[model samples]
Structure formats: structure tokens, C-alpha cells
Target: MWRNVRRPWTAGRLYEETLEAAMASRPVDAEARLSSPPRASILLDAEVQPMGPLAPAEDIRTDPATWDPRLERAYYDGDLRAGEAVLELYSRGVDVSRIQRAFSVGAFGLSRLRRMVPTRWSITAVDDIISARLRERIKTYDWIPEHRVYSLEAMGNRWVVLMSPGVWTYESIEAWYPGTTWNPTEDVAFVGDWEGPLGRVGYAGMGGCYYAARLAVTEALERERRQARVLVLREIHRDQLMPLGVWLVRESVRAALRGRPARFDTLEEALEEAGRHLDLPLRFWLRVSETLGGGRQETLSRYL
Candidate 1:
């Protein structure tokens, strides 16, 4: 796959692999140096530069005839901020993925403030911004009538979304099995983050996957005009040996939520249903979950 990369490097070739490979090949002095990590290049040399404004290609002119009218206006306007542009685009029925791509290439935001953003950061930024606005609107909606559990398994991962009757609150938990992409040790690793009615203040410990899954869950609630305390539990199996982008979390959770969820009369029954699809026991999940415990007004159970 290295030879099949589209970009042609004048100096030499490039190799693309999972992050696990890069970490394994790290030099002994990588931790001691203040500079960047040693790149895993074979017969190739490259230069690194500080963050700076990006220059667009000369021939890439905007065609008014084929562009969305609002996005076109945002492109030339010098006053609209990036966050406002994103919300407007979404209201116009634009796809989030399309917005992310345009934002990456400096197509949105004030003309003077535009700069190319790394694809990874731009994805999370757009997701977080749009979802934050959605959360505000969802707060006014009624809570779901009952506990619901939605489950899906794909790409060597199992996803379970447990939505309980309550106000707008959310949490995302991930259990990476040994030999998986992020967990290389003999023991399974559990990490999670949560937000209450007031919303979270900083970046989640689980990183972009938290925002990505939250975006999907909130979109579902917005559609039905309902709110709930959402808990997303993911089990990353050993088969998931590579680190794919956060899109996996967003799209897979969206697909799971779209399916018919098993309804339950009580929170206990919902957790029992969700436990069947995952490899781990429910007690282990509760040990690390704050949203399920009592992050909101009501506690699901007194699990210790």
C-alpha cells in the first residue's frame, strides 16, 4: 500500500501503517529529545515546519454557478466566524462530512482567519461545535418514555447505546482488549468521560471518539424531539489491531441508533439487554461509568 499512495514525493517514497507500527519503531532516544519523534522512513528525508497560514492552489478558483449560496457567501465574507458558518451550513441540510472537508481546506470562516486545519482536528471541531448547539435545543425536548438499548457489532468492535429517561446528559466508555490498537499490555484497559446537565468543560479523556459518538446520539434525539441520559459502551476486540479514524465511532453509532432498539420498562432491564452484546460483565462497566451511577438527578442503581 505504500507504493500505491496517490501523492508523489520528489525526494523518496512514503509508508503508511497503523499507529501501532510507528510506536513500535520509535527510537531509543525518542523520549529524551525535545524535538519530534523519529519518523519511520526508508531512504527518505523530510522537513517539518511550524504552523502557518496555508496558501491555496492558484488555479483552484471558486465557481459561483455550482457552489451552495450560503457557503459561497461564507467563503468571501470577512466577518462570519467558523462556528457560525458551520451551524448555518448544517441548518441548510449540508452533510457534516462535507462541512468538515471544506473547513479543512480553509473554505469556511472569516477570509482573514481562514487556514488549513489538520483533518483529524477539524473533524472533532466540527462535531463538537455542531453537537453543542444541538444539545442546547435538545434540552427543551421531553425525555424518552422508557429505557432503550441499541447494539451493533462491526469492524471488530461492539457498540451498545443505553438511553435512559432523563434530561440531556451523556457519557462514552471504551474497553480495549489486550492486543488491540490502544491497549498493548496483558490486561484490558478501561477509560471513559462524562458530561452533566451543564455540559462538559474540557476535552474528554477518551478523546475524539467521545465527541463523535455524542454527535451521533444527539442527532438521533434531535430527530425525535426527545432527550435522555445517554451512555455509549464500546468493546474493542483483539481483531481491531489498527487505529482507524474516529469516523468509525460516529458512523457505527449512527447505524446502531438507526436500528430498532429493544425497549425496557426499567433501567435494570436495559443494562441487562445491553450486557448480552458486550464481552464484559455489566458490573465492570458500572465501576467506571458516572452517567449510569448518578451523574444526573436519578441513580440507575446502587452498584458498587
Candidate 2:
């Protein structure tokens, strides 16, 4: 006889349910999961700017004494359940930078099995959660009126954002240099898993960089109160010698969005405009781009 085994929920579903619960009421279950004694408040009620620089991980680790006792206890008890509670605090206006630091020190997840998550992992987790929440809002908005191409360069990384007037879709393409973090020898490229209007089925294989870029682009669309089919191309040059963490990807994309993009009448025109600024040829980027390359003939058919 075979016993039935229930399948676990996807991270996205868990995130949505957790967020819904947090918005509706205090997360009592999250609190119950905590192993440590409860405190009056896990996060203090303080006003903080929405976006700010991330503190170095070393700084957070070296000064664990400064961490909030209540939040620390919550993490020790509930693990990811505690993280949900922290997200609730964030919704109530606590500083994100502070919450990120707390997570870095192993203060957000399971208490009994608590261990410091690498800074990169912590950062990405936060980005994914926050962006997932943001996506819920942006999906209700209108689409852009025209195609637009935005580009920027920082720390030897070049970023190009191609926005198509359509339902919300996002894809990120990363081209790693020979000596860069993921590619230590010959140049290589990878496309993050695509997400349609309804959202992604699984985590992006490229990891944190994908979430960071998604968050940045989502913020731009939200600001305009308009959605789009967004394709982000990131090219890493040998000059970037070392891994600067996902923060670089987040900030650089954010910076590009802040600037005015060159407008175009069509996707091909936008790609042509974006190509002028990239280190690699437009053909190379399109070849590796799932959104643009594989589907190009079909996409161009309507125009032709």
C-alpha cells in the first residue's frame, strides 16, 4: 500500500497567503511559531525613507549586540514565519534597511535552527518578497502607450530595459564576462525564467539578480501607473573583476529607470536604439534573449 503525500506550496503562493494574512490581521500563527519569549513590539514604530543604501554584511555581523531583542526572539522561534511577521512590520512603515540588517543576522527565520544567511541570500529574499507584493499592485494598472528603451552603465555592467506596451511580463538576460563572478573563463549568457501577466511559475535560475532587477523595473511601472512587457539586458565586462553583490544590479537598474528613456514606435526600433549603448552586438543579446530572440519572427510579423 502507498501512502499519499501532499505537495508543498510554491514560494509565491506562500508569500501571497502570508501577505494577505499580514494585511488582514496580526499574524498570530507566526508569533506562535516563535521559540523565544515575546516582546511588546517586534519592530518599533519609526518613520524611514523607503529606499536607502544597504549596510555592509560585515558591519551587521560584527555588531549583533545592537539588534532588537524582540525581533531576535521572533526569528529564534518562527523562522520564515517570523519573516512574515517582519514583513507585516514593514507594511506598517518600519524601515526596510533595519529589517534587512535583522535578517542578515539570522533574526528572521526559525529560532531553533537559526543560522546567519549569507548577505546576498538575505538581500534577495527581501527583494523577492517586497517585489512580489508590489506585483500584486502593478498588475491592476494600465499598459504603457509606446515602446521605450532605457540604458545605463555602472561598475562595468551595462543595463538596457526594453518596455513594450502590453500586459505585465518580465524577462532578464545576463551576459557574464570571462573573469566575472559566475563566468571565470569564457564569456557566457543566461536568461532568467520568464514571467507573464499572471506571474512566474518558479524562482529565476539566475537568483537574486533577477529579483533585484524585477523590483527596480516594477517600481518604475508602478510610478507611471502603467504596466509593460519588460525585457532587461545586463552585460558584465571584465572590468567588473569581482562580485559586488546583487545591490549593484538593483541600484544600477533603479538609476536607469530614473533617467528618461529614448522612445520608439516599435520593439525593433527600441532594440536598435538600445544596441548602440551595449558592449555586445544586438544580435548576440537577442540570440540569448528568450523574450526577444526565439519569438522574434512572430513578434515582427505583426509589424511586417
Candidate 3:
């Protein structure tokens, strides 16, 4: 598979088994130094970058030719809203196999690659697989130091963000269409790094909507000290999104979705309900923005 991983990070079709293989080859914690990352020769730099980072740009939004109609409608209708999206999956009651299936879209969704893939406890079974491999690796070798493994229980698969930071990281992602630059400054997006062991922690960084959409749920889960945020994004990219795109964009949506049997029928209703969960109502922008923005109001306002 290593030979087959021509584009390991982006286009490579990574299965749960692939995760096991990578972990089997990884170095133990003692051997892992403060390195940038492994030499993933299979990385396809272009495909990992999402085309929708420019979704907020007036030029693109007004120009229908550049953006997909369904995508734009879903974005406006709150289908891609953060909290709403995550809760949808959490409420679905699916198993780890589905979670693994969801992540098959080329290297665990760029927004959650580090969070879901390299970490000890993953949102999907792959994390378990990796951990088991790590444990086995330890058992097979005495030199491997005993280290505290890290795993995450995302309440929803759709919302845990892996935001990228810095300009080069964005600009270099020319694999995306022209004029599309990764926006680290927008509230529509947020920050996170790749997932790894104890020493490899994901940091907040600038990002695209793949992770941006998750920022809302990520914050809420962290706020509530809940499990890993769950999600049901049709796909990570905006160009190819799922139908019935109702993003449960806030706390109310999460609660409503978590209610059994999956009650959501539409996106508008989801957004309306999500408003109820907020400290401020949906119609009130200033108040809701302030609450959601926390202290980062100034920086976030520019994007909103």
C-alpha cells in the first residue's frame, strides 16, 4: 500500500487497514522528536485544499457559474452550519464502520485529518486500530517507551476542525482553483493542526470551511465537556456536497438532533431551533455574534 499511496494525504483512498499499516510503521514516542511531520511522499498537495474558502467572497457568491447552486443554497440555508452539521451525525446512531466509511474521502477530511487519523484515540475505529498497533509495537519491542496515548471521542464526525495556519500553507495549496486563497482570518473558518500522539497536538490555525464548519460544534463540545463532536457532512468539499443539507449550526440544533429518530426535516427549522440554543436569538445578529465570537468579536466580524 505504501507503493500505492501516490497521494497519501489527498487523493489516496485510505481505509481502516491503511491506518493500521501507517501506525505499524510509525516510531515509538521516545523515537519521535519534535519534527515537522513525516515525509509523506504520497501527499497530493492540490487535492487537500478545498475550493470553497472563497465562498464568502462577494464575487464568487454573486457569480453562480463559479459556485454550485446546491452548495450556495445549502450554505445559506444553514446546511453547512457548524453545530447543526455535527449533531446530525451524533443523532444518526451509526456505528464505527460508517464513521470509517465517512472518512474514506481522501485522508480523513483535511479539517479533521490530524484529529482523526494520527491521534491515539480516533473518532472512528481507525484510532482504535492505530492504538492497538501502537500497543502491539510496544509489546514487541522493549525499547519503546511507555507513553500516555491520546484518543478523542468526537460527539459528531462532521464538526471537529483541523484548521490550517499561515499564508504559504494556504497559497501553496494552489491545487484549488484560481483566486481561492485559504482564509485564516475569517470567523467562517478557524484553526487546528494534524493529529498525532502526545507530543503531536493539533493547534489552532487558519483554515477553510471543511474545518470552519466544525468550529462551532468544536467550541460547544469543549464548552460542555462533551464527547467528540459528531457530524454528517456529505463530503468535505462544497462543490460536491450532500442533498438534504440541513446543518444544525448551533446548540439548539444539536439538542434537537440528539432527540431520537432524527427529527430534522429542513434546514430553516434547524437554524431556527439552533438560535434558541444560543444565548441570543437567531434574528439578533449583534447579540448572537458577541456571544458566539467570545472575545474574538473584532476579528470574526469581518467574515460574518
Candidate 4:
């Protein structure tokens, strides 16, 4: 009746009217995503970034921020940055995982190079070494397996591998947590993990080997600091993730919880148990966080 009222409204007219009415009725400021939760990117281990120095502040080392980008790019690709300083020096170009300044490569990278040099290995031969010789070293040494701590080392050093076989293999990394929408193009480097890369890193990247690596290094360092059974610090031949590795101290507590312990149920209990096993200073660092930097470990006992 209304369509025919004024002079027979056509179907097109009605459609136009309907659209206009609908658009007019809508709010000007209506948010399309009113229900979305606000999220932000943050580092899991901010305090984990080391401060001061292994020796004095003056003796402090290189800056990571200024590290050569080419090397970083290579590392982001699927290449393992192994071998001696010259050979294994990671670069962003192609398949090289360059070491950031200050974060030394230590023994792992060095030994890999030493092996490669003597063997004059082809790429296939080198790949075989990763599983055979490297894997063998991992089996025999406590250091190779990874730990709760890592030690700094000088180049051209001879060191025995140290690390135990790891349990709780990191079967997979589900996602690159949080930010995924942003484009990584144009001089963009986020201390962020891309889902694909992280998955690759995640696959065989479990908490146990990490725990072993950092723990052994820290134990040795603590001993050195206290001048009690000082273990000689070894050079990191590739980019060492020791400081980053300590974040898993919390995971250690979790790993400990998996089994039935004689003493307790909570991770706190396991931590306390582990603490008692370590000396006072080392235990102190363990408590504050997974570990402490050289400066933090020395808390100015006698006021200057």
C-alpha cells in the first residue's frame, strides 16, 4: 500500500530507501571490534639482559644492539652458526647465524670449526658431523647438552664437552605468541620470533637441555667468583644464549614437579632443595631469579 501510495513506488526506490534508513540509523563511531582484548608485546626475560661485566665495569664487553645485521639475518634463516671464530662467525648474509657483540661463541662454535678444518668436510660431511661427532659429544659431555648457565670463553681454546642427555624433549612450539599481523618488511627486526622460525627453533628446543647448559655454566662461574673450585671459563664460539637460557629456571621447577620427589610437591620445594645443594652465593642468585649477572652477584657488601 505504501509503495503504491504516492505514485506507485518501484522496487528500486524501496531498496534505496531501506539502505538510506539503515545507514542513517547506524552510529557514526561504532567500533567493529568492540570485543577484542588489548594485547601488547613484551619480552619474557627483560631482566635477563646482562648488566655490568664479567670482570669490572670497565672490562665490560660489546654491545648486542650494534651487532652486524647481516649475520643476524643468516641466523634467522635455517643455518646453524658453528665452527671456529673465522669460519663460524655468523653473518646475516645467507645461512649464517652471526654472534651479536659481547655474546661470545665459546667452545661449541670453536670446536665445530676445529673439527671442520681438520676434516676439510663437504657440506654433506659437515651435516653428518652434527649428528655423529656432535651428538657423541653431547652424549659424553655435560656442557654440550645445555644447562641452566653458560660460560664465556676465549678463542682457540681446548675444552672437553659437558652435558647430560636431556629428557622432556620440546616436541613443538605451537605459535609465535601474540603479534602475528605485522609485516616484517623494511629494516624491521623484532627481538620477536616468527611462528615459522620459532616452530623450527621449538622443535628439538625443549627445557631440559637448556636447564643443563645454563646450570653447568652458572655452577662453574659461581665457583670461580667465590674462588672455590673455580672452573675455567670456556669461550662461546657461536651466539651464546646463556642469559636467555636462565629464564627456564622456572621450568626447572616445573620439570622437577613431573616426578615424585622425596621432599615436596611445589616447584618452590624443588627450588629450595636445589638451593640447599648449592652454596650460599649461588643459591642467592637462584632465588632472586634463575640467575644473576656478574655485577648483580656482587652486591657491594662493603660500601665504597
lDDT of 2 by residue, 31-93 (tens): 113334444433211111123332222111111123344454444466356457566756666
Best by lDDT: 1
Query: Could you tell me the TM-score of candidate 3?
Result: 0.18
Residue lDDT tens for model 1, 1-304: 2222222111131211111122121212211112344444432111111223333222121212345555666666768899998898888887777777667656666665566566667788999999999999999999999999999999899999999899888999999999876677999899999998889888887778888898999899999999999999999998764667787889999999999999999887888899899999888898888866655224445544
Cα displacement (angstroms), candidate 4, residue 126, comes to: 15
Please list the residue runs of candidate 4 whose C-alpha ends up more than 4 Å from where it truly belongs after superposition.
1-42, 45-87, 90-133, 137-205, 208-304
lDDT of 4 by residue, 1-304 (tens): 1233122123344333322222221212221222234344333331133343122111112112232343433333333434322234321122211121111212123222312111112222222222222222332333222222112212221121211123211111111112222222432111211111011234223222232333333333233231111111112222333233222332332233233323333334333443443222333232323112224335422221
Cα RMSD for predicted model 2 = 12.3
Among all windows of 10 consecutive residues in model 1, the one with the lowest summed lDDT is 13-22
The regions of model 3 sitting more than 4 angstroms off are: 1-269, 280-304
| Regions more than 4 Å wrong, model 1 | 1-70, 295-304
Taking the tens digit of each residue's C-alpha lDDT, what string does model 3 give over 149-258? 11121222122111111111100010111122332232222222322212123322322222322333333333433332132221112332221111222222334334
TM-score of each: 0.77, 0.68, 0.18, 0.19
In order of TM-score, best first, we have 1, 2, 4, 3
Deviation from native of the Cα of residue 92 in model 2, angstroms: 4.9
lDDT: worst 10-residue window of model 4:
168-177
